[model samples]
Target: MTDHLGSCLCGTVKFEVHGQFDSFYLCHCEWCQKDTGSAYAANLFSQSAKLAWIAGVDAVTSFTLPGTRHSKSFCKLCGSALPSIQVAGLLVVPAGCLDIEITMLPTAHIFTSSKAAWGQGLRDVPEFGGLPH
Candidate 1:
């Protein structure tokens, strides 16, 4: 019954998802990496959660790969990733888009075979609380 609020980087799109996520994943597939412009996509999956747009629903745009199931929802203004429905039943929410705290961690790194060669050894890098000056 928990409600999660989310918005685009430009604040042009706002929404809420009502209910808990059933699974979380860090997808490292090439499509996910391309969609996120990162090494992986952190996504939460929910089959029963309902998405309600609070504002600017028209500002959202979605693209599904021409010959694949890969799809992405993003804000038209800032191109920030947003939530999208998949496989007709599951809702896929990008973890970074949520305004509320996420209690569930990623369950696994999926499609590791397609991960970037330079994506490994990230833990070996120095950690910082903020940008290192």
Candidate 2:
């Protein structure tokens, strides 16, 4: 029963997950790209893990994509992505929100058929420790 702590970017919400993740995924779905404003969303899924809100639970807000099961939760103040409880007892936690380091690698890249054209060959791009001058 490993425990992981997480917080929103503005420190408005804090939470903990007490159990191991079942899987990790990098989703390239269009809604994921639009909501994240990035090529994909890095998420961890757990079926048996328990989630606890340590603080500022009211600061969290969620949205579901109309008729789709796709849903996301974020901090109202900073708008940073947080954890969400999906259908069938699935807990989806954004990897970026975790305060502690995660040892698990992504289980797979999902929705690859919708991968962005600009998302390819990212490894070939120049790496910088910080923003390039």
lDDT of 2 by residue, 43-106 (tens): 9999999999999999999999898998999999999999999999899999999999989989
**TM-score, every prediction:** 0.96, 0.98
Worst 10 residues of 2 by lDDT: 63-72
TM-score of 1: 0.96
Cα lDDT tens digits for candidate 1, 5-124: 999999999999999999999999999999988999999999999999999899999999999889899999999999999888789999999998999978888999998988898989
- Evaluate residue 4 in candidate 2 and report its C-alpha lDDT on the 0 to 100 scale: 98
Q: Which stretches of candidate 1 lie over 4 Å from their true place?
A: none
